[model samples]
Target: MRPGDIKILLVDDEASILQFLELGLRNEGYQVMTASDGLTAVNLVREFHHHIAILDVMMPGMDGFEVCSMIKKMAHTSVIMLTARDEIDDRVKGLKLGADDYVVKPFSFQELLARIEARLRNQFPHLLNEVTIGPFRINDQRKEILFNDSMLSLSNTEYDLLRYLVINHGIVLSKSKILDEVWGYDFGGQENVVEVYVSTLRDKLEDDDHVLIRTIRGAGYRIDLP
Candidate 1:
């Protein structure tokens, strides 16, 4: 998906910041929603499904950390916490609380926009219908994977990795390629995450009935359909 195709929620008690982000992001072709406080942002999230959110740490009523926790609990929505605090503890706390990323206040709009784009790319990797490979089927739209007519439970990362492989069935994809395509640049060379999620997918998809994901020895992995 492109920058403009994503829907974003921007929350800040500061009217100026809210307006600035709304205008800048909208000009870049994104569907933007703005809330002046944390509670309103939570309500907006409940009312509509946003692709990503830019939240201010300081807000009236509720704080951004609380809102971030609420958002993370509901779905795999990407959130970037915005704060003027430069303290390392605050950043770590936000991360521990489930914020996808964090940005210091006085940050450049270009940087924030870049981070938002990267987050959206990671969250929604494809826009294709349910794809079938051998006995396995992946419903990208519903975020589900099915094997031999039985539904398989998969984590968010597992679903994305599986879908990426299935979409390119029969084609070998290197670890770097999988990381670049599935995790996005924001993942920062954490390629071991690919292996972890692949292991999870294997446990769910590989059994007596199906074995679609195949490792390529020293190369990478692929989805084999036969």
Candidate 2:
């Protein structure tokens, strides 16, 4: 999706920082929402579906790490932690807590925008243009998947996994392969994440008697298209 089509959430307790970043991002054609604190950020998360979130590490009531964990559980929103601390431990902590990227204070707006674009491109690769598999259709430009002409309310992660499976249709993809492709190469998460997402997709796409995605026993999962 284009920058104009993507929604971003900016959360910082510092009013000046929030306004500066929000104004810069908005000028670049991104739909930007700003929150002054972690609590307000959480409330905004519930209200709107954000594709990316720029969260400040130091916030009252709830910290960035806590907020990141909460948002990750709710949706597939990619997170970038903003902190003045340049300590290695702090950066590692944010990554461990599921933040896609971290930026230190005093960074340029151009740098931040570059990072945002990089993360988005990584999530939605260039190869994901459009693919049709039987009754299912994937349109990456629109960031949507259609099943029998109806749109599927899929999370970002769900859409990526489903699109990957359809691209490699009829091939049994191992969990490790899927993890690298869908969750990224350096995703230090459990393999069961793939299983959980696959199960979710099956529930949404499969019928009681028909299975679009098949488990290949010791192999992996495959979507057999006619």
Candidate 3:
């Protein structure tokens, strides 16, 4: 996915800091949402599906620790605590509450961006790189897949399904989740279409032994990538 496709949440009680970050990140092509308080930030997390959050610790009502906890309980969003205090106690508190990183106040904008990139690299590495697994190579930019040194002619649906599985390799994705993601939530197609498409992809990849994609019987499908 491109930079604009990654949604980032910015929360700071200071209006100027929030505006500065929103402007700078937007200039860098990020989709950003800002909140001045913790409750609004939590509500946005529930709706925006943000990939990462930069939260200030000194908020009025909820504070950053509470917001960080709420966000962790609900979403898989990576959190970086932004605060003026550099005390080890505060850092430890944030880390114990599931905050992924810590950024001190008075930090440069470039440093913040670097921290964001570092977090993305650790948390969602698949989003920023082409995927290669054994005999398969996936170029997301070109939306092309090469298998065994041969390009596979894939329909759009097939490409989407394959790429989704490849990026999320080894994760057991349920039929309902796959259906909503690949076929879209509004798709009128039958759920069995996922199974059919899986078979088609396996055949195209020449996986007659079904070793590439494994079915968990009662659970779902997981792609094993080398």
Candidate 4:
């Protein structure tokens, strides 16, 4: 699924935890909805079909375990239960109650992110393969790119740059920022490299007039359909 297309639900009684996870996941490009209680979480899930739900096992009035079962019956959304207790019974109970995974409290964001991706890979594998933008199709698994049904041969650097541009399509990307993201921090002081690669990519894309990837004069480069 596209970043904007992948919706995730976050439920935690702790406002701090909800804020932390919402901000972190949003930066990673997922659409996030946070609830401070189980009822609100259920209401959100019932309203929108979220791809995943991260629920705290303990809550007032209703708990994560109760929320998980309700979510499963209401929507196909996958559940990842969270808790401060690392008890086996808690894990098993959450799993048995329709939570796809269980995460102990104090877990690193990276670990939770890994589990979220694992669930996506299993349940929504198509999201991993093809991400289409305008006339471009990027297949990260095969390391291949297709434009207008024509597969383009590209070096690793070129491929990364193109994918980055396609991902953030229509946004002006400054040379310094491109250098940092596409070429790494070690590529600092090499702004000219961005020009060279853009030139090559334009040529390969048959965009001789720079219509596909336009130079924003004094600003930077932006890709827009001609």
Candidate 3 residue 170 Cα shift, in angstroms, is 27
Local accuracy of candidate 4 as per-residue lDDT tens digits, 1-226:
4667788999999999999999999999999999999889888886777899999999998998999989999987788989999999899888888888888888999999878876775466456767666798878888889999999999999998988787666789999889988889886466888999999999999999988998998788999953
Top candidate by lDDT = 3
- Candidates in order have lDDT scores of 0.80, 0.85, 0.88, 0.87
lDDT of 1: 0.80
Candidate 1 collision pairs? 4-29
Model 3 per-residue lDDT tens digits across residues 53-145: 999999999999999999999998899999998999999999999999999989999999878876775577557755555677777667788
Off by over 4 Å in 1: 127-226
| Model 2 TM-score on a 0 to 1 scale | 0.58
Worst 10 residues of 1 by lDDT: 121-130
Please write out the lDDT profile of model 2 over residues 1-226, one tens digit for every residue: 3567788999999999999998899888889999988888888988788889999999988999999988988887889999999989998888988999989998998899877865665564443355556788778788899999989999999998988887677779999999998899999999999888988898888653436888888888998877
Between candidates 2 and 3, the lDDT winner: 3
Write the number of the candidate with greater TM-score, choosing between 1 and 3: 3
Candidate 1 residue-wise lDDT, 1-226, digit = tens:
4555668899999999889999998899888889998888888887778888889998878999999999889766899999999989989889999988888989999999767755654466563344555677777678898888999888787777877787677789999999988888667867777787888777776633335677787889978877
Pairs with backbone N, CA or C atoms under 3 Å apart (clashes), candidate 3? none
